[model samples]
Target: MRRHGWRWVLIGVLGLLVTGCFAPSGPRFGDGSAVPEEVSRVRLPVRPGPDGTWVVNSPGEGLLGQGRVLVRRAGPDRRGWRLALPAEFALTSQRPGSAHSAFVGDHSVVLVGGREGRRGPSEIAGLDLTNGRLAWRLRVAPDSRVFSYDEGATVLVADCRAGSCRLTGVSYPTGRRVWSRTAPGAVKVLDGCRADAFVADPVVGRAPCHPYLVTRDRVSLLDMADGRLYERPGLRIPPGGIDRITENHGRITLATAPAKGSCRATVVSESGGDGAQDLGWRYTFVWDQPQAPRDPATGCRWDRTLPLTVVRSLVLPDAEGALVLDPYLGLRKQLRRLAPGEYLTADETRVEVVHASGRPDRPLHPTRTPLRPPGLSPAARFLTRLLWQDGRRLVLLDHQNRPLWEAASACRAFMGDGEGPGVSLTYCDGPDLVTVRPAWKD
Candidate 1:
């Protein structure tokens, strides 16, 4: 009897220990704050996928490893899926856009890998999103860089050495070689501008039709299907090395910064001291115009800084102010008098200040009660949504800057439309992939 009683007591103690290990200690929200009932959370180790709808885990070291991938959707039910990548091979997402590393096609999630373990060649793997199966694998040149891909095809720039690069294409799902082309000069691909120019080719389906390749001397468009080169002589390469390129309304703008180590010491008369700092420069070019590119500003501004490229706006930050380009790729205006803790961001509509705390300095849209204390009220009939980055945490805010929801992120990046009703913010939070839908209406 005593032995039986002791065994029962031991089992009860073990049960309590297991429960303590798995039970929720407090709240998932940062700083011990209670997570609101409307907010949702999921825990998985991952990075942001190609789009806001999914997230994929980073690969382990070697040519053959395994990890997990997840796809999430937004709605009342918030249904989604997850799959552990097959252990037969290893793959990783590279050169991601917004928050995506691997390309999520209509049918599969494609990932690229470099030679790591005993593998001799670089390769790409396609995993079926439906059943978590490895559908295809293709060995590519060790130096090749995948520029664009989809369910229809994959395009890349290969053998970029000895002053030239080769454009190559491969068929989808089958991993068959299709076509390749050799270019004359060192090729640099401008990421966002597709050679297809935003139009879907009827033959290529929705795959990235072609990639825009720029060289030391010219800008040329590559044909992804047959490797045809369409050279545009109208696009001239302006003086000062092109550091960044963006396309808007058929016009291409390239921003240039001061040459490396081109700093001149300045005299401080009050203290009889001299100091030197790097300067920044800006340049803009056109697509079909015959004239040379324009240099609108020249001064010792600051160290080299990359242009903040957006869909409709290009902003070059200077020590004095920020130069904003209009929709037509022309100088719109220079924003001045920025506060010390403020950062500038311009969309198609207006210039706004992102405060140091990650919240905007003011409401993005018209506020129904600008002076009222924030928080949802019974009389509130509408709500505006905005995303703020507080360190590694993503905060969802309303028009009045009230935080409706929050989550941590590993990449500190966000994707999807915040202004829309159903669009969700998908990101990775260390070992967890999270998606939060903003309450866009009262």
Candidate 2:
């Protein structure tokens, strides 16, 4: 635990640096010939364009203009730079609280703000990605936090007012509150735990004990759609106490350590239309150093005290953060291809490949199949990149969960497209948005 102390601290520091930028590898081109390099640092509004180009436009008041300002997508492809958006456009946001952002479907972008007392997100706004036109903006709660997005341009937000928080489903380009329900508390959806809309009751204002079981607060799951909420799989609190409840994809997990030093977890799958619990599995591990937690030497042996179905993998720690595993010997098959000492994070259906050096391993070619692609209740499929946009910054980390690089600007707007080596992104330093294509120095 002492040896791994620095890692935990570094993770906290790097969490803020998730969105990162690259210093373009110089003179390189997707084409065979290396010609004069395009200057990436410019005083223009920029965005990543289709086909493999960077869109740049002359400055305007608060948007990109057509007559006074020219827009063009520039790249080495020689496709004759395409005309960029004619309407005004600016990734620079005026809302408060990191400008909660998400892309709608594929043609629109959304930025939301509503952190009480702080710089408030006066409105939740969406824009046409291609034309840079105003799509819609909704007036939201002063303390609203947009968590995830839909395939289209929709968002799920936590609107906390007075004392209770409501999980509201609102559509973009129309700012309509399609569905909403009072949330249990500050329950967060994890990246890999994989629960779509179903959230555990994060009992607030109560003791750290299991309030759902004691108070019998309804255990419910909300559909991420513009639909309804359902109460299903009424769960019970185990003996010891619940360490926490997390969901990724569609998998909902309730964890406790019944024994003194054992880690017991109950995993529940979302019911299929009907109100059945669907499938529930249980796992237990007696970590060698439970106090340390996340210890690589902490061998996982199923308690077998309880029963489980469709056992997937045991999560263990690497030198960096942690990795997922199958119950059998060695590592999980999904991580079989990883070199010795390398690590991987399993969430939803994707496996992130890590190298022994604790850096994200981007193979020359693309990676396809997931060693153990599991089904889920929530979470969308994403690329295998180390960093992504959070508001105006690229939130990225290194293999050891350290900051990859710091941005040179205050960051006004940011966006990441695709996943893995194919992942591309753009961010703003005021109005100067820089595009970063996933690539590495050999």
Candidate 3:
């Protein structure tokens, strides 16, 4: 007994030491008492047509205009360019000269060559940020979308017209085509992982529309480095159907509605194998109704209605298996299990239950209690968007979701640009990077 007690004591001490080293310092909130210092304003150069329709920089070092193509610079001295296609080339609406603009970090002054309503053949041109000189130009089809870039070496372009599509890997400096592959049908670029890009085609069978009309609804993995294509199995979702697919840890996870009209999720390993053989575990939510009530005080409008089925929002960390958030039964639950493989099912799985505070007595309640532990305060939850794991400790954020303060140090905070009407606070943290933004009216 004495020997066992000594061993346990040593283990506990070692655990404490490890925890102390990795423990994150508590969060710090700005006192509501004092008015925040003003941030400086900068007058960005106005483009030709629209006064403010140019581009706005988001919270991070990214530029957001039309789609998810948020471009950022590799470094402060480095500049990145994006060739925007003409509105006629776009499947959607056009935003003036923004039809061709290179997002150089937060500064969106670089204008490439493309007219608002122009169609057919177009040449790509980018304004240099360093010396205000013309960078490079390339001839491209009207319907081409610039997918990615690696400095000046290569740029991937996806040209889609009608129901036919072709992906070309082009050398930027020489305007020479490195390699090109034409799919049989309209292809949608899904996601990029590692050095490969995943695309899916939805039209199969004999269609006499374009050069590649017979090959739709098929998934293919293409090597970005060389434009090599690896065709995967056919995805037979219903017409006009969409699936949420994400790639993490070299594995592809797809959530789709099964033919039986139930939501299902499948995980596929990067290793090539039979398509059906690669299906991972499947889960079905048993709720009679999945949608939350607009007013928690009022119970679901139709208790007698059949339960709606939906896939839970799951976040899988590289090392921590899968974390599924089940916001049902008035409580939030988390499921953690080994990495799911093909043919696995969520049956008899042990899940940790996070109970909400207070019981629902009335038909609806104003404040629905949290399903998770109270360890995360309201501010922490609001700042969850900015919370990312660094090592073991989570990097905390300010109220604005900016990474102003890391939880590593208790006393130090990182403040960003303080010029205009934007709120700015001093930090005991390291030197701040001052960025200018347009003034905002209260």
**What's each prediction's TM-score?**
0.54, 0.40, 0.41
Off by over 4 Å in 3: 1-114, 118-123, 126-129, 149-153, 161-164, 172-176, 185-214, 233-245, 249-272, 275-442
Q: Which regions of candidate 1 fall more than 4 Å away from where they truly are?
A: 1-83, 86-94, 97-100, 115-121, 149-152, 193-210, 263-307, 310-312, 327-329, 332-342, 346-351, 354-442
Sort the candidates on lDDT, descending order: 1, 2, 3
The most accurate candidate by lDDT is 1
Superposed by TM-score, candidate 1 places the C-alpha of residue 175 at a distance from the truth, in angstroms, of 1.8
lDDT by residue for model 1 over 252-292, one digit each (tens)? 44544443344222110011112211112223321111111
Candidate 3 vs. true structure, TM-score: 0.41
Which wins on lDDT, candidate 1 or candidate 2? 1
- Against the unseen true structure, what C-alpha lDDT does each candidate score? 0.44, 0.38, 0.36
Q: Of models 2 and 3, which has the larger lDDT?
A: 2
Q: Write the per-residue lDDT of candidate 3 for residues 34-148, one digit (tens) a residue.
A: 2222343222121211321224333333232332222332334555444343442231223212244442323323333454565633555443444434455676777565543
Task: In angstroms, give how far residue 27 of model 1 lies from its true place.
Answer: 27
Worst 10 residues of 3 by lDDT: 341-350
Lowest-lDDT window of 10 residues in candidate 1?
A: 264-273
List ranges where model 2 is wrong by over 4 Å: 1-44, 47-100, 114-122, 130-133, 160-164, 179-219, 234-251, 254-279, 284-314, 318-323, 327-442
RMSD of model 3, in Å? Answer: 14.9
**Model 1: lDDT to the true structure:** 0.44
Q: Return whichever of 1 and 3 wins on TM-score.
A: 1
